[model samples]
Target: MTAHFVQVANAERLAADVMADVMTPPPPVDYLRWAEDNIIFTERESPLPGPYNRDLFFYFDEILRALSPDDPCRIVSVHKSAQLGGTVLANIFCGGSLAMDPGDFLYVHPTENNAQRWSKMKLVPMLKGTPALTKLFPMKARDGSDSVLYKERIDGKGAIQISGANSPASLSQVTMKRQVQDDLSKWEMNNAGDPETQADSRSQAHEFAKILKVSTPLVDPGCRITKSFEDGSQEKLYLPCPQCGHMQTLEWENFLANLDEDKPENSHFVCVDTECGGVIEEHHRPAMFKAAKLLELNGVEVWRSENPKAKRFHRSFHLWSAYSLLQSFERIARAWLNARGDPASEQTFFNDVVGRAYKTLGEAPPWEGLRDRAAKSDHPKGRIPVGFPIVTVGVDCQADRVEFQVVAWGRDYRRAVVDYGVFPGHISTKECWAFLDGLVRQEYANGYGRKIGMDLLAIDGNAWTEDVWGWAKRHLSSKVIMVRGVPSESAPLLARVKKERSRSGKLLSYSKRFYNFATSVLKMGLYRNLVKDDPLSRGHIALPRGLDDEYFRQLTAESRRAKRLKTGFIAYEWVKDPAQANEGLDTHLQAEAAAIKFGVRSMPDSMWDRYEADRERPPAEAQYEIEDLMAPGLPYVPPAPAAAPALPTKKLTKAKVRRGKWMNADG
Candidate 1:
């Protein structure tokens, strides 16, 4: 007892002093200064090795300062391309946390494989190179104590865990003071829930937790990083033009006029400032980077939300490849040269190189091009050309009448519009049914001088469901089918058919059943094909001369718009014009659906090669010859008059005539 303590009457004072010392909090640390002083960059892990140099990447200094424990923001958002050194910045924050503000921290990638690769190629090298970081984790690789997925702090009270957005279970357990998410665009979408919302839950337990998110922009309209960036004080890095001294965000658009696809090496970049008209040179970038400033909006800027009051507790930054020191203007021009003609490459250049979301067209291409491409052939508006081996028909069932388009298909997926016609009359009436019977039964001259009837027909059954069911039951055959459009953007262009019972409750027995498709997918394909089609390329659809501006406008009636989802990703949806009709779009999509039903897209390359070889030979010498088949003759069909008759819109005249433009003159 004497050795332990003297039992004095005033011993309470000593106990009170000890408690106060234990309760006092540690002093605030300067995160950016500490990173520069203590952090190490390995040759294997970083381009600039040894002590972390702040001057090399001045843009990241302010970012780290905001992430410091003393900063008011609990979340940090980073919207960037791969060239912006976002990956290195994330590693620096984690390293700083390990040294100064240690607590449970998390590093997440889009997938487990990505996380593991980053851990080994980046994290391990970083830790091994830095003395302070190395002391935090086990040194020996053989030490079964820690794996690539986890690094335990020597204190054991904290850890740095590596996880993937795809792994729900692994992401759930950790309660962290800091979390860093990289390549968020690549994260798998959770059907049952959102991976991001779930990941955000981990930091819920911490009072001053920090969240950092980074990624290159994807074309997706509802992309996660966009929302993350919007949640903060949206900041853009503004650098003065090397020549003009006029300040602006660097963009590829500034280089477009100087781009020479034919000679990318000689291509140049010019300043957009009209007053300066300066050509940007490779040597001018260093000074530009040095002078670059991360700018916040002044409340009235173009992106209005950049206003002060709009900002939340998070700080967001957008960095573009235009500011990348490693890339040269010539290199950027070269990349555009390789991407110019290809859709996929173009998207990549815009997303990865320029750092922007893929733009989906809300406005159709100028009509003048389509109108110019349309030249009158020997074939009339409704006549099939001799080259098309198969003719398919699609009917759009409107409330008053059925509008239809006929398409001609060849061996190479090359197509021509055989006809566009409007069949007027109530679809439920016998006269309308009679008109339909006449259209499907009519024959058109194939290029080989033989007559060919439609091999497949897909009627729009989405509307007038029961009426369509009755019609399908009457005309249900291998050649005649019904189709419905799916709303999902990701659904396949052509989905597997689901069998349905006839009006008599009889199940359709064949595997080739209803032709249901994703209209959205088909529209995207059509839009891309319209814009990217090179006359020399395959799978091009030619518009006939007789198609007026109204037809083309109707075909392009729907414009695509970017819609943000709750997940912070964007999806493109077709918005119909109040002034125009989508009858042209609907009919064309159905025809495309019919072609898919004919297994045109799925034909084996060998089969296609054989078909191509055979198409070159004379019809007589061809092994696979399309039969000059005509369906059984229908009752007397009348030629459609040039103008609409005086009949009421709702009235049907079956006895007077089965009137339709689709009827063949010879019939």
Candidate 2:
């Protein structure tokens, strides 16, 4: 067995040696000679004016050249960059192959417009150009279709046609030697989900047996064309490293490794793979290159030309050569950088193009200014911080315990979770009552001193709703009320009312007034409006300084794609990451909404009637300030003066209230 294994190894080595000896690079074949002997050609100039006169080969002619005498490569998937003469190259390959072996050939592009464009721009021009080719077959733009051509061969005639990727019916009727998918990624809108993308690709694979996919990369890396190249069968066009014989993909990363940073703009590829470290110039490329129309070499599954050992003129090449012809190195470099590599052409190199976006995301949002201003503003002694105007207490109730916080926003719109409550989760109804009484008592004690009112309290209305509301209705007076309904919508209203800015631009009041004022400020568009001192009402205290700071950072770092709506552009907000926005908005919206519905003012009978009348009027006629009607309580009236002079007032002492032992014991 050992001897047999050694003999097999030796035999394999011998065969490899013989193959390498025979694999010497062939001399460059002249285009003119190859055309006469191998390919039938027709040529024409481009309809659009350009530098070179048109002398092109037809699709069938090239197809004929690429296929074998008896059996041909069934499919060719061409992954391509834009332009670069890929379409023309595909045409040449198909035409040359089909011309030799007369068979059906179907061409597919993303859309009908593109199909027609390819027909006019590439297929027709090539057919009309070459003198010998034009005589062999003739084609003209048909009335309803793009173009049609005939291939009269020794055996039989073949037909070539164009079809759109979206038109499945047209594609199903045809079976051909070659299937060409041009820019499949362009079939769908960016950010769309289409099952047809995969369906069409698989269908085409079955029909043509041989697939050629070609496309430019989409904005998203997960595009259909990209997936096909990565996951589908690959006929990788590999070039040999100058220092090593190993074949590896030649990608933008490989290209950038050769760049000379000192001469930043003038850098090119130099093979520096750990083993090679060889600088490969363009002139030496032809000899170092090898072509193998790979079939199922890796996990990729594709139908190869029936004969696996057959080495034919079936070639696939990634021609970055077209870059120099159509666009500048800078333009291509930027696009290349955007794909995987960093852009090298811009003034700041990486930073100017990519770094700026990074910087923006890294920086804080402008709203941070409002947070700082709100935080820094002075408040009356013992009050919740001046920044905390509208305070919404969120309570999580359990059988034994109730947990809550008085989140206060200052007059400037800054907010904070000022206090919290957590009792036994298994507490009884009496205990729950005690918990409620203690919370209100503590709030009144701290809040009245600061002169900052506790605007609203939102309990978990999802559970224990009846218990919480009933407890509040029985024990709590009009001094404060538990906010009911959806906190997400109500908290903001309360926060808006409590928000206030002083004449000098500093937040002054920590009342329901502040919440109202803040909403008005936001309504006027706080993000865009730059205050003289605050500059962009971001400094408005609607949220806590800490939250506001982070929120601002997120807002500035992110970009919004404002979509056009019937009325105006709806700026769908974006955070750099999904997690941040999800965590923040729930708290912000709920807290803000809670503030809106809390501490609502009562109106007088006459004023109420008038407001009702105005509300009944057409919205156009309802011009009165809605603010006044929404304020708490009936209108004020003055008391009549006494007839005689009043006695001088005297201050009452604590002795009066604690006149007896009972009052002293209670105190």
Q: Which one is best on lDDT?
A: 1
Residue 130 error, candidate 2, Å:
3.3
Candidate achieving the largest TM-score? 1
What tens digits encode model 2's per-residue C-alpha lDDT throughout 1-667?
3554333468788999999877975444233233444433333333334332122222112333333233354433344555445555565455654554345666777666677877776766555664434644554334432233223322335556677655655555455655566766555321222323432444453433555666554322234454554443334334456566445444555556655445434434555476676665544444443121222234332222222333232333222431123333344354434332111112123222221111112122465565565475443212344223345654445444554445554322334444322354332378667766655555322222222344555444335545655565554333333332221100123333333354687753332222222221122222322232441232333332222243343223333333434432122222244433221222333344454444312223464454334322222322445665666796622122112111111121223312311111123
- Write down the lDDT of every candidate, Cα atoms only: 0.69, 0.41
Give the TM-score comparing model 1 with the true structure, all chains together.
0.58
Give residue 661's error in model 2 in angstroms.
57
- Model 2 poorest 10 in a row by lDDT: 354-363
TM-score of 2: 0.38
lDDT of model 1, residue 467 = 70
Q: In model 1, what lDDT does residue 573 have?
A: 62
Error of 2 at 546 (Å): 12
